[model samples]
Target: MDDDGVVPLSGGVMKAVRLHQYEVRPLVEDVPEPVITHPFDVVVRVGGAGLCRTDLHIVEGQWAAKSNVALPYTLGHENAGWVHAVGSAVEHVQVGDAVILHPLATCGFCRACRAGDDVHCEAQAFPGIDTDGGMAELIKTSARSVVKLGKGVEPAAVAALADAGLTAYHAVKKAVPLLHPGTTCVVMGAGGLGHLGIQALRAMSATRIVVLDRNEEALALTRAWGADVTVVADGSHVATVLELTDGKGAEVVLDFVGERGAEHDSWAMTRRAGSDFVIGYGGTVDIPTIDVISTERNVVGNLVGSYNDLVELMVLAADGKVEMLTQTYPLDAVNDAMDDLDAGRLRGRGILVP
Candidate 1:
């Protein structure tokens, strides 16, 4: 068995980046390769592991209590790779198949899984966060968590879609119905997910898109991605959006940056019956019940996404409708990648390749 108590692969040991302690930097070391254990298990040779802000939170002890994870575990959640091995019970995917993993490994018997909402499974473990993940040379995942990549899509290119892009797609999917040709949609924080959300809105609906961000580069990127208007996230940005929307405010506000009072400003720009979709963390949402009743506004929270949502996102990638800007790093540079992401030096998603 490996350190995670799962079946060990026959290749002896492979290089992996692991968390030795909470609130500390992770180290790269040699660990046993993962193997198929259960009848439905699948082992994948990792191609790309996305560096996400969530990983930084895990390192800062923010997720120590929430995830309840043990020490000395690999830590990359957004993963994509090639199927290297599978158990006898696995049937849909074959060896050598390129695939992207759903972040959550869920039990199909759970009520949430039956309803195709596996993100809320009763018995679920989040890869990287709760157990071993794809930061290593190989990883073990359930067959239910694997989605084969479509043609023209490579694992390294779309690995970030497993989480960041999927979250954007999920929130935008919910807000699409409320957005029409004449309606206005506001995107807060045109970062990785926000950039993807802009493209999703362009592909799914014809709503006039307005993006707000303090970073000029992010705003420029959002504009190139099809945002109808770009506003710097300052004191007057909400008023600008209101003016652009003919004094009625935007019909939908997607808050990708919920911290540092971004949510409060986003809510003010939402129309009377508009929906406020919250995707980022680190802040609390406090709206009075009276305002909720008077305006009939909704405050919705988004988790990462389901397996089907990942499949759909792959389609968009294959069609060139949505493309992720990835900065590649060798596995040995995992710490450097994390540092760049933390320092805000990276423009797009950071991908670590083995």
Candidate 2:
């Protein structure tokens, strides 16, 4: 190893999940292992790579125009691992340090990056989206995107928090000031991200939390996670949420499930002057012009999160205030993880361990 932190590479090969075409299952193929190539590059030995619904969308050609990602690339974005090697100038994280990735490698000098909103950095590289990602045995990232984990904390345990939990926390934190006591906050869905949103709300605010999910089992989990009420999301859920909120609606409605008519229902359950936050994607918000103008409701969008957000979320995780329920699959069984996610069989997040 060099005094500058650069380590010599072995020039080896490793297993990686690569998608050669859209609308088809990606396969586990032997690919060249990542190696440090830049002054700030840090290659991670992947411990866990989260299987996200967005990955399904990508495979279905949903992100084709937006990401413009070339095919035959690796696909796990929410990643956490140990630093297997680092570049010459990298110092914050050393080789063998446990860490979680930030999902985006950004130019630190950009206006958004300077303001801590690195998600919108002018020059950004979204691994697993537009470039090679962490679904492999090793992944290359920048030093700025790695957050060291606490002692005894496993990278696989918190890998999804890098994106799923981080996005949930970022959305919930934005509404913290609005979640005063006696205020009713409705969370739509209790899957991977929504469950974390419930826990984040439970930890950070005193607002009453009402969760809606199509699955009764998920509703039960929401209860154990500190929800004040739970509703089975069907055609009647909007009425039930309104009834729970005294014929009006919740001050904040977080739609973690944006598709399958959840968007309209979420908007319908929001208070007239309240805010509706959309975290999930793949659906259009089709409210009438009059509805927006007369109700004075605000529709807010959410991205992955910032570097500070990931750091703070880690503190919460380390203290045991937030934990994502995850089902682990060996790297070779990544397609099984994706199948469970697509079939809605996963109780929480699915993690691919390499």
Best by lDDT: 2
The deviation in Å at residue 205 for candidate 2 is: 0.5
> CA shift at 215, candidate 1, in angstroms?
1.2
Worst 10 residues of 2 by lDDT: 2-11
In TM-score terms, candidate 1 sits at 0.95
Clashing pairs in 2: none
- What is the Cα-based lDDT of residue 176 in candidate 2? 92
lDDT over C-alpha atoms for residue 296 of model 2 = 94
- Clash totals in order: 0, 0
Each model's TM-score, in the order given? Answer: 0.95, 0.97
- How does model 2 score by TM-score? 0.97
Q: After superposing candidate 2, which stretches have Cα over 4 Å from the reference? A: 1-10
Predicted candidate 1 versus true structure: per-residue lDDT over 35-133, tens digit per residue: 676778898899999998888888988888888988989999999999999977789999999999999899999899999999899999998999998
User: For residue 7, what is the lDDT in candidate 2?
Assistant: 64
